[model samples]
Target: MKQQILFSFSLFLLTFSSFYYPINTASTAPASSPKLAPAPKSPSPASSKPLVPTLPDTSDSTTPDDITKILKKAKTFAILTRLLKTTEIVDNLNSQLITAKSGGLTIFAPDDSAFSNLKPGFLNSLNENKKIELLQFHILPQFVDSNNFDSLSNPVETVAGKDPLKLPFNVESLGNSVNISTGVVNATVTGVVYQDNKLAIYRLDKVLLPLDFFPSKVHASAPVAAKAPKADDHKDKSSSAEDNEDGETTQGQKKSGAVSFITIEGTRTMLVSLGVAFVAVAMI
Candidate 1:
């Protein structure tokens, strides 16, 4: 009876141990594997700056304010901004563009490359008045779109100035392309930046040379077909020509003497003829 009791107690202990062992294993398996880490916090948007400097987009609407805003955003026109600031005309142009019912500005803006391509030190050498004139030359009192340039009259008067004839510019348009000729420089508009009733900005392949600034270059020195010699210079020229002829003759004689003296073929022929003569004399 004691053996039976002990066997029942042992079976009961074995069943309890089996159940507790699996529960302990299930609890320990979770602790053995790695737990995921929390994600790193992102930097604050307010503290971050853009890699490239960019002004706010102002192209959604059109106004004189857009000009200044676009200029600040456009890295291509940085040099143009510097020039406008230097000339102190940025505010004036901006004012004209923003004013109600005022004539807007048509600006032919040359790219940075075009300005750099200009002759070194050419702009720096100009006087203050010439610089102002150059700035004025690029601007027209009215906004002129590229499409209208084809039919536009020659000498489109610019804010720069005008004569009784017409404006300083001769604008020639072919299809979408337009060529601007300032008696001095001929440039084709490569592209348009901004176009509106108030302001139009066109990019040019070259810097427009103002006729007033470059009057000498406008009409090239023509090759004279013939020039009548002045009576006073006639005698002097005649004497100089005769002197040149005499000098040339003297030089020819000197060169002939130098070459003819040491010519091996001529000297050899002469020597051979003399030898034959000596032989004939001996025979005689």
Candidate 2:
């Protein structure tokens, strides 16, 4: 009976200890395993900006105002433009403008109507040198504005030279009106075509006819008329016979042929025809 009680007490103690302590399932997990990290996210297309193109810079580019271009654009100076080209004064004026530092040009530009008002055969009567001089006579080497006419003295020098007896001209200002006298005809400044500090162009009512061109105004003394020489009755018939025998003209015959050659009138007519044709073609 004492042995059975001792064994029963020992078994009770063992059951009581097992019931007080429980088995841990989390502690049984593997300690060697590592934790995994989450994946990174991609960026959205809506967050980006668009690219733009750049433009070119052209702030400093500018063109010059040429004389011919100005006249051409004006449309009334067509005949004058043709004359300028024909005389090559356009090239000379452009070059002068480029080379001259302080000097500029003032032109009394005659319009097509002014040219039309000229007497017939007047332009045709001028030789090539005279034609150039005629154009030059209308120009002043220095620029003169319409307001400054009062400041100028009489006998204003021109590109054609200011000879008191010949090419001398006078500029008179009455209020706002300007009158130019060449001792042959008086021309009024009708209007201002173009004006800059460097260049000045004025509209003229008529072409400036220099005093040298008009003998009536230039010459103070009237000359006596030349008398016709009396014909010689005596003749060298032997020399004439020899020339006729040789079938050649004598000196007298040669002189007669020269007298029958193109006269000033004939030349004037030819030039008038040519000028008419040229003007017609240019207008077309």
Instruction: Give the distance in Å from residue 204's predicted Cα in candidate 2 to where it truly belongs.
Output: 0.4
Question: lDDT of each model, Cα atoms only?
Answer: 0.72, 0.76
lDDT by residue (60-127, candidate 1, tens digit) is: 46464646566555467767777788888877888777674966778887778888989999889988
Off by over 4 Å in 1: 1-60, 164-167, 218-284
Clashing pairs in 2: none
TM-score: model 1 vs. ground truth: 0.54
What ranges in model 2 sit over 4 Å off?
A: 1-65, 221-284
Q: Write the per-residue lDDT of candidate 2 for residues 84-186, one digit (tens) a residue.
A: 8888887888777777777699988888898889998898898888888988999999977666777788789999998878897898877657889887789
